[model samples]
Target: MKKYYWTFIFLYAAFSTNAQVKYADSLLTAGYTQVAAVEYERVLFETQDPEVRNEAILKKAFCYKLLGQYNEAYQNLLRANLFDENDSINDRLRYESVLTAFMASKYNDSYNQYVQFKYYSKDTALVDQAKVIAVLALNEQQKWGLASELVSELNESYSLKLDTAELFAVSKRPKIRNLKKQQLATTFFPGYVLVREGQVTSGLLSFTLKSGIVFSTFYHIIDKLYFTALLSGGMYNVFYAGSTEHAIESIKVNNQKKITRFNEKVSNSLFKALETSNFLLF
Candidate 1:
């Protein structure tokens, strides 16, 4: 009778764990990822089974990843034990760990994880996918030579090589701006720097504002309206000075934006290469 009671408890525990996992999976399928994550956590808390805990951790990490909490996702993947025991789960764990690390912009970590994954996993397809990620990770770190070598080994088309070359060229190109000259231009003419920076509308607006302020102040002074002139003078001092400083800063901002856009283009080119190869992990 005592043996039967122990058996009953074990059966109930197994059933309960299965039910929880199924429910979490359903929530995840329904796109209620946050709730699914919570349910997965509950499973982790109740289960001592290594396999169950690892699966729960993987699912929870996926939920976090979907929510763009990549660092958390990567950390959860780190909690997974029993590497190489189950090939399927191990591959998934390694892939997810690298992916989450990459998404979090921990490129070095992502690259290292990929190296480890590559060493163990026998799945050529998955290794190819990871190689793409590894190339990107190296690219992010400005390791152009390594990225080039890895990408070349991928045996992709010539266009990919061209795109990679373009990325390298763009990175090496000088940023478009002359800060000292822009500041000098702004000091002499409030909006000239902005106009030169191709922010024509903003430049015109700034110039019009300063022009109006100055005209109003001078007109009041000439009309012997001393108190009004004083007020206008105050506005002139504030707007003129502020506009000069702001114009230089605006040109700097625009220059930086152009640089950022260039960088984005480089990243997009790499992503496009991955897409062309059908190895885009996400």
Candidate 2:
């Protein structure tokens, strides 16, 4: 009797149609967390099969969250909620995504998610988790008063894992922050100019338009992020870089009216082409 029952149990567990629970667990054990997440997502698509879809999805969101892919987790949680908005689990998942986003220092994203889901989750564990995480996230975003209130709430919550002392330590810990990249500006002013990284490129000088001699030429972008301005240097000295767009170049027209007008038309065409290109860096 015992042998028969053991065999029966083994077979039942193996032949189960709900593969998500087993697959996700197996993948996690095998260190394929991302693969587990994918398996769970597939289970979510099969509506009739309700074995462990929620569990699987939670696992998936967790995997993404652990891997520091907060955006991916946030999207998955959002999709899962669309299927069953009332699922407290989805609310919890939203809160989890918010925490991950906070840890990742994506303050704007985290704050937005927190605001959307804070009212829905009633679980003490999840609520405390969110409050604690959100306070720090808000602090990172320079919201001091709100953080203090959140911290105060956490301190008074009986279900909180830590007391006020631990809260201080957790809040003080450093999170991985987003690095801001410095973007170089591209400005052609009203005519042909050379742009380069770190320093201005060569060939901007000696570009002369004869007085009353209008001429147009398409200056090729020698490289990426470079600008070729077909400009009538009449009055304006366009400034676009960090601080100074000074009236650097002095413009003069040499006697040659008809030729200068033709130049203007050609330069205009080139400028249009450059504008259409995506290579122009902001």
lDDT of 2: 0.48
lDDT (10s digit) by residue, model 1, range 1-282: 234323432342343347788788778767798998999999989987787787788778877877879999999999888463667667878887888898899999999999898898987677777777787787666566777666676646334544445556645643667777777777668778778777789888888887787788889889998899899888877876776777777766877676556546656776666567546344
Q: TM-score per candidate, in order?
A: 0.58, 0.46
Identify the candidate with maximal lDDT: 1
Off by over 4 Å in 1: 1-23, 30-32, 48-50, 66-72, 82-84, 101-124, 134-150, 155-163, 170-189, 204-282
lDDT of 2 by residue, 1-282 (tens): 234323433443354456566766667557686787777777777654433555565567666765667677666665554245445546656766676676666877787777766776666565655655576566556554565566556445432333334333444433322111111112223222232221232223312322121232222222321233234332113223211222122111111232344334433433343345432211
RMSD of 2: 20.0
Clashes of each: 0, 16
Clashing residue pairs in candidate 1 (N, C-alpha, C atoms within 3 angstroms) = none
In candidate 1, position 96 carries an lDDT of 79
Residue 175 local lDDT, model 1: 64
Judged by whole-model lDDT over C-alpha atoms, candidate 1 comes out at: 0.74
